[model samples]
Target: MGNGHGLVTLLLGAILMGASSFVQGNSSKHVVCYQGTWSVYRPGLGKFGVEDIDPFLCTHLIYAFLGIEETGQLRVIDAYLDLEDNSGRGNIKSFNALKLKNPVLKTLVAVGGWNEGSKKFSVVARDPLKRAKFVDDVVRFLQRHGFDGLDLDWEYPNQRHSLENEDRSNYITFLKELKEGLEPFSFMLSAAVGSAQFSAELSYDIPAIVPYLDLINVMAYDLHGPWDEVVGINAPLYAAAGDASDSTGRMQQLNVDAIVKYWLLAGAPPEKLVVGVPFYGRTFTLTTPDGNQPGSPHIGKGIAGKYSREPGVLGYNELCELMQQEEWTQKWESAQQVPYAFRQRQWVGYEDTRSLSLKAQYVMDHHLGGIMIWSLESDDFRGTCGQQRYPLLHEINRVLFGANTPTGLTQESSDDKPSEGFRCPAGAPEGYVRDPDDCTKFYYCSGGNTHSFNCPVGLNFDLSTKSCDYSSSVKC
Candidate 1:
């Protein structure tokens, strides 16, 4: 009787565990992070390779920039870098190998980017035979490389440098064909789409394209850049008061809220819309430092980033370093729910944990599918900036998957006191604790208790500093 009772208890426990897992899986938000293949060649930026990714952090990891050949065949941008056996270091094998860590993590190949150009896509998508061949080729390529699916990033369907007018309708047809082809294999189909009103209207028939797609990853960033005549936020959550102007055309509807609303209003299902969050910032050289607000005069691009090596752009890692400079001042725009930095003649618009937190909340409140990050390599994966490794991704996970926090880690409260009956074992390493009242002020963990410290206003804690300091002063 005792043995029978024990067996019954074990069976009940196992059933409960399985049910808990099911509930967790159903509630978790889909985090799709793009991994740029070209980032492997950027030397100064920690030379990020596929091996650097933390597969457990994201639900889907999309390998970016698989070019479309003129003949409508899918081709890797660099065969040598992607496929060559670098003693188990090759991009393709290394990326797929991430499944060893998290078997459920999905990997997809992203075809086309800003530089890949849309000519090939437009040419092939316009012809039925070519489109069929392209669809088959994409499936074969993904299967051959062990990819879970494909992400089409054609920039725009019917815009400058691409086929005009018919391209938009043809795009829907192409997606339908691609979905039909991949249906047998149960593969996922997603697309990276433009968020600007003009581009969205010209590029996609939202209602028609919806049935064929698993998710619509909106490119919410780049709404404003150096190309614009006036400065603007990189990815504003909301539009500011009196910010409306038909003169700038689509620029007026550049915020995330407007983009999401447009798609929803245009018949996109809430669960299929994945809002994008940029892991980088747009930079501008201020024409006059006195008036640093958006639309301030700017003559040229801001100082080029050392690692990104791009004028008017800076990755989160670079931005974190730049914030260390005493001259740089970080300011938040309540209306936009985004932050910007300025120093001397330079100004930058970018997202941080606070802004990203709000965005995540917005996603949850609106019943959206999930969040998509432009490029994972731009993130401070190495924990050099101090908050935590993959801080942006971590915050998203906390907000979206708080019920199942990874590794059994629980979020610490702002109360500055350890939880009841909690005690750290002896010999734990000292670390920085976040202050709830102020993000710039952090507490140091020593002797199992936290001691509070404040960083100068506009400056944040640097892990290297062991104290609050200017962004430029930290050697991240």
Candidate 2:
């Protein structure tokens, strides 16, 4: 997902951009929180709350994204019977524990992440009946879990891996049907999007899909991965030019902020977009200048970490334990406000309380909806990291939502300031245009004259038509 060779270049680019805190304009004010499920599948991990970690960590989260498997034998496809019941009946105890603690927490089951969800989604979305069955099954699953909504993390639509074409039209049809079927429950629908520029461009017709969804979870992390060579960049705010920051001394690539802006400009409403934060760090073994230099080059395997690995990625759980054991020292990068560490010839990049605190600030400053973590169980409940307190959820609430409690998360009163400096265009309504000079950037001509312009971007704009084309893109 990212490159080691591009790390240095992106890092330098970020530095040049200056580490200023983001400030939100009037349009970006929605926030949704998320938590993934893989850690729950492991043995002996359920009593996360009772085990020392803050049982109430998820209490203030506006929405928690749970993962589910689409199991099958005969594909009976009842709108209610399609979801695998593991996180449902089997995991009720844990979920109920969370719900009882925080009544306002909205839990949405996310179906199909990176590797495990494509097959079933492809099958169900292609056929009307199967799609119906899936929608019905999803509804049933929600009712069974007492869930507040559903998030379609279909990894991709009309494409395999990273390539997609005409089949994309079929993808929207599937969403339209799902949206129609789930309307009765007022179910919240959202989709997890890729952070890579190419992936975002061709993956989904977001503007077309906006009508069918409540939010779009922009998976803003994983810009870099183990597969890349030369001390790779995990994530960057700007794409690197050449070989500026790595083992090859070549420019690193991928600009996360650009991805965010792309979606914003493409019609995805800022309020409906949730930014993703990884609960783990991609790991790589690097050759050192002298075994003491943390910025060494790779020598071995590039893998994900759990607890501890000299040459692999480290999941949040392991990272928390390390913080507690004092096994590694945490360092913060002013550039991205993310944290990284070096221990036993290994370099680990991850998020921490301070770093997360800063990110929360960024979210509020930029008016982003809220933060979304990969999985819920990765935080350290046992205080394994000492007094610094990796109160991930708490930090989010404190900084972005301005809430001391669950109710406060969504109930804050806005200042309602009138943007008096800007004026509406000659023919536009008072609030429709922010500034006379910026009208063309935000609005365009349509049916006749007065009411024809659009409100810019959302989850439903058509790329090819330069308008809202849900089915496909048309260059004309």
- C-alpha lDDT score of every prediction, in listed order: 0.75, 0.50
Tens digits of per-residue lDDT, candidate 1, 4-50, equal: 22233233323322322322433446789999877877876457888
Determine which window of 10 residues in candidate 2 has minimal summed lDDT: 16-25
Runs off by more than 4 Å, candidate 1: 1-28, 85-89, 245-249, 403-476
lDDT per residue for candidate 2 within 53-73, as digits (tens), equals 232334223223333333321
Worst 10 residues of 1 by lDDT: 406-415
Show the colliding residue pairs in model 1.
Answer: 323-471, 324-470, 324-471, 324-472, 325-471, 325-472
* Cα lDDT over the full model 2: 0.50
> What are the models' TM-scores?
0.79, 0.66
Score residue 382 of candidate 1 by CA lDDT: 77
